[model samples]
Target: MSDPSTASIVSTPRAEQPTETVSPVGAPQGDRKEKPRGLLGDAWLDLRRKPLFWISALFILLFLLMAAFPQLFTSGDAVNGSLDRSLGKPSGDAWFGYDFQGRDVYARVIYGARASIVVSVLSVLGTLLVGGAMGVIAGYRGGWVDAVLSRVADVFFGLPFVLGAIVILTTFNGSGTSNSQWKIMGLVTVSLIVLSWPVVMRLMRSSVLSTKEADYIVAARALGAGTGRIVLKHLLPNCLAPLLVYGTIMVGSFIGAEATLSFLGVGLKSPVVSWGIMISESQSFIRVSPSLLFFPSLFLVLAVLSFVMLGEAVREALDPKLR
Candidate 1:
């Protein structure tokens, strides 16, 4: 016979005893916090903590504002300059001084943002649309489709970027038609897009190949989802991170390429103020007015650097291996 207290304790129902708090998966609910879901959610959480990401993002926003509204940055005329003030030294009112035409270098630099930013952005978007589509189709339907697309991409990838651009632009620009700024912009945009998309296509193809085999994709297909549904609903989201990272880096490259083409006289010509045009036009007067070259070059370098930094930050954030 046991004591009454011992008997009562022993007689207590097993269900009434205190048990460790268990999660739905049967793991002890200790100090672990719930992690973020999805690629973008995790990347965003990490990006928010990175100072470099914020700084680069802020710079990009400022550049966009300058591109959209040049008037806000400067009231002076970008084109109209006094010959007398040509190569003028920096004054109280004009921080960047004057160009060879005596136009305000500061104003031109501010206005130049529009062309470079617009061209780069448009080219990247074009690349994404054309290249991304091809990549997805090839990746999702392997075999002969992949072979044909891969071969075509390889052909384009073999072309020399600058030389090819020069040939294309010269052919179009010398057709005896009126070379308006808009027309010139279109030609440059087309040339860049044609030459630049191969890289994106290859990246997307590789990413899709690795992602399509994922369990979720397989399950989605098993659940009677159509081809388009599985590709769009399941695969695209997984592949987008790499594309985004590549596109961000490619923006800076496109900007630099545009500048290179412009410097070679095949890019944006006069009347459309671009940093490239400014650099090319000022090379002759580099000895007399170094500021003309200095200011545009500085702005271009800063813009490219900012985009590259932002891309690297995003890549780091998105890579699970980094964590």
Candidate 2:
């Protein structure tokens, strides 16, 4: 027995060595840190791990912010009607200078982003919905349905989109008011949807055709799954990856088409600021006021290039072969 004066010095159980904590060696790290499981999750993981993805994301976000807040970055009115200081060069006050109408180049470019993004996004959606539906039907049915749809797509693809848009706009030319801009945008969007869906349709049809022949599809069919049920439950889900990749690439193309049509005076009528309008305006003052040409063109190029780069990154990220 210890002496009465000597108190017991029992050591506390070493703080119980936290079971929740993880060591770098091989121990569990906070409940196994559940890994993300879906396509979006995988894409996010890939994006975070990739330098190109982050760089592309950053640039795109910067442009989007600029587009959203033109007033924050520039002076001189974007939509000022009167030509008070037309063709002004870059100054401390006016960052990107003024255009032929004294409207701020920076402001117009920023505003143009709205039009570009809207058109691109809508066109992509339209293409996916129309084309994807048609492709799925045609590929799965593969009878007269496929024949009729294929012929229809071929006919539209053969017709020149730019020329068709020009003709449409020429026939429906408005007084170039605010209302006219909306009408022009609608027409352009329709024209693009008509012509653009074929490529996506082709892609979707091919993808569905291949997917429908897979072992899983056969197994589903043998399990008494009807055509509608099989397609809804299985085929469509498998086709999502390719559709997404194609849709991403098509956004850039649609933007380019919109810009082209606007430049030709067949899209985005007056009162609607756009890159096409900027280029069209610059045609007159190309010799004297090159800023009109340079800044808008630069933004357009940047927009297109950024989307293209982003599409490439997305494709790589989604590609199982790459993984």
User: Per-residue CA lDDT of candidate 2, range 48-164, in tens?
Assistant: 788877777787887777667766665545677358878888987777888877777877888887787777788789889999999999999998999999999999888887787
Model 1 scores what on Cα lDDT? 0.91
Q: Which residue pairs show collisions in model 2? A: none
**Candidate models: Cα lDDT each:** 0.91, 0.81
CA lDDT, candidate 1, residue 190: 94
Q: RMSD in angstroms, all models?
A: 3.7, 7.0
For model 1, which pairs clash?
none
Candidate 1, residues 90-181: lDDT per residue as tens digits?
99778899987889999999999999999999999999989999999999899999999999999999999998998999988874246788
Candidate 1 residue runs with Cα over 4 Å from true position: 1-36, 175-177
Clash count per candidate: 0, 0
Worst 10 residues of 2 by lDDT: 3-12
